[model samples]
Target: MKKTRKLIYLLEDNDDIREIIAFLLTEQNYDVCAYPTVKSFNEDIVLGKPDMFVLDVMLTDGNGIDVCDSLKSNQKTHHIPILMMSANTQMFTVKEKCDAEDFISKPFDIDDFVKRIHHYMD
Candidate 1:
């Protein structure tokens, strides 16, 4: 018997952070498709959606909150869960503005990160 891995779309500007996140998720049996820019992610979203989305709160090109709000408002991708990753201490303010499922402040414990991810898993 085998398990079907969940596909994750990760958007982060820092290459090292993205790689580390991808590695951790992959180690946990997730299929991660990471993008450095929101532009690339937006382009790929049209091709297909992912099981989950992990977005950086601050992007070089755009704000992740706007991205999450757009996706939540859309008809097609509204059901997918989105997790916002940020180092911002004012995450509650940002979370209140958008319709993200949850948020994780950066320098977060790996155990807590995994636990939060599972909390939203279907």
Candidate 2:
């Protein structure tokens, strides 16, 4: 039997950031489904549940905090680990308000980012 790759749902509005994150996660041997906005993420979530989520705090259509809240509240997806990304200094407060398992500050170190993702997976 072939081993399945872990699927990660990523929601980032910045084109470059989304691309870079996709590339990085792919190189690390995980499957990544990236979206440009919360709207797209919402559309995909119903199709299947990802192993984990990486959500941007500020989205073009909606904020990630609410997304996190919804996912956590839902019985189907409540157990999935969420990594909230933000440039905001008060990200800890935001994380506390939601159900994110961890957080990544913007302009984050790529090495550290991978580490955090692994932390969630493990």
Candidate 3:
């Protein structure tokens, strides 16, 4: 039987980072829906929830920690694993504020990043 690809929703404001992350996840055989802003993410999330969420800490339109908290609080999406990424905020600060499954600082190691995503997905 063929294995089903896991779906991942990533919210990042940087165009290049969004593309790179999406590319990396896709290469790992995951389906990725990447959004550039909270507004865009909100619009797409209503359609369906992904198996996991990768969110940035600071956004141009909104805060990623706020988004993670909302997702963790909601019944429909609370169970999905969230990995918070931020260059501006401290990892401990993000952890204290939200219930993300994991946290990664900006300029993260590629091996560690993939390992974290696999830890949740696999």
Candidate 4:
């Protein structure tokens, strides 16, 4: 049987960031579904769960940490690895509080971003 490629669910409010990350992940052979908010993400979960999640720390609707907490707390989705990104490195405390699998600061190196995605996807 052929193995299925892992899917990555990305939640980022920035259009440029979303496009760039999506392009990068696609090149790396992962299927990506990008969303701009928790509401849309929640809606998509009903369709199917991704192998992992890439979440932004801030959104127009609310804090991404809160969304991460919700995903982690839920039995159905808790197993999915979550990689969070933030522009504010100072929010390391908040990132820790969320208990994400990993955290990447914004303006991050492309190589580092790809490495983190591969790390979690693996």
Clashes of 4: 0
- Runs with alpha carbons beyond 4 Å of true place in candidate 1: none
- Using all chains and alpha carbons, the TM-scores for the candidates as numbered come to 0.94, 0.96, 0.97, 0.95
Scored by lDDT, model 3 comes in at: 0.94
Candidate 2 lDDT tens digits, 1-122: 99889999999999999999999999988999999988899999999869999999999899999999999999999999999999996876996899789988898999999999998876
Q: Global lDDT for candidate 4?
A: 0.90
The top-ranked prediction according to lDDT is 3
Candidate 1 per-residue lDDT, tens place, 59-90, comes to 99999998999899999999999999999978
Task: Give Cα-based local distance difference scores for all models.
Answer: 0.90, 0.93, 0.94, 0.90
- Could you give candidate 3's per-residue lDDT for residues 23-89 as a string of tens digits? 9999999999999999999999989769999999999999999999999999999999999999964
Model 3 collision count: 0
- TM accuracy, model 1: 0.94
The digit string of per-residue lDDT tens for model 4 on 1-100 reads: 9889999999999999999999999999999999988889888987887999899988988888998999999888899999989998976686667979
* Global lDDT of model 2: 0.93
Q: What is the lDDT for 39 in model 4?
A: 89
